[model samples]
Target: MVDLQEQAWAALLYVVLMLVQQWIHWIPGDLG
Candidate 1:
């Protein structure tokens, strides 16, 4: 059970990280 929870958390973290990258890429200016 603990292992499954860890995997789920890791997946969620990865998704959130990707979304943040996309969000920055979409924004205009020097941050991309």
Candidate 2:
């Protein structure tokens, strides 16, 4: 059970990181 919970958290963090990276890529042209 604990292992599964840890895996879920890891997956969620990975997805969040991916989204943040994409946002950073998209934000530079108009604002800067």
Candidate 3:
């Protein structure tokens, strides 16, 4: 059960990180 919970949390963190990266990429002047 603990392992499953950890996996879920890791997946969620990965998704959130990806979203943040995309968001930054979308904003103008963010490339610098």
Candidate 4:
């Protein structure tokens, strides 16, 4: 049970980090 929750949280964190990375790459393009 707890293990499942931990995996879910890890997946969520990974997705959020990916989105943040996308934004970081995207913003430079918009400004430049």
Residue 12, candidate 4: C-alpha displacement in angstroms: 0.2
Off by over 4 Å in 4: 29-32
Per-residue lDDT for 1-32 in model 1, tens only? 59999999999999999999899889999754
Tens digits of per-residue lDDT, candidate 3, 1-32, equal 59999999999999999999998888899566
**Least lDDT summed over 10 consecutive residues: which range in candidate 4?**
23-32
Give lDDT: candidate 1, residue 19: 100
Candidates in order, TM-scores: namely 0.82, 0.80, 0.82, 0.77
Candidate 1 structure, TM-score to reference: 0.82
Q: Is candidate 1 or candidate 3 better by lDDT?
A: 3
Arranged by TM-score with the best first, the candidates are 1, 3, 2, 4
Cα error, residue 1 of model 3, in Å, equals 4.3
Candidate 2 colliding pairs, count:
0
In lDDT terms, how accurate is model 2? 0.93
lDDT of 1 at 14: 100
Task: Give the residue spans of candidate 2 off by over 4 A.
Answer: 30-32
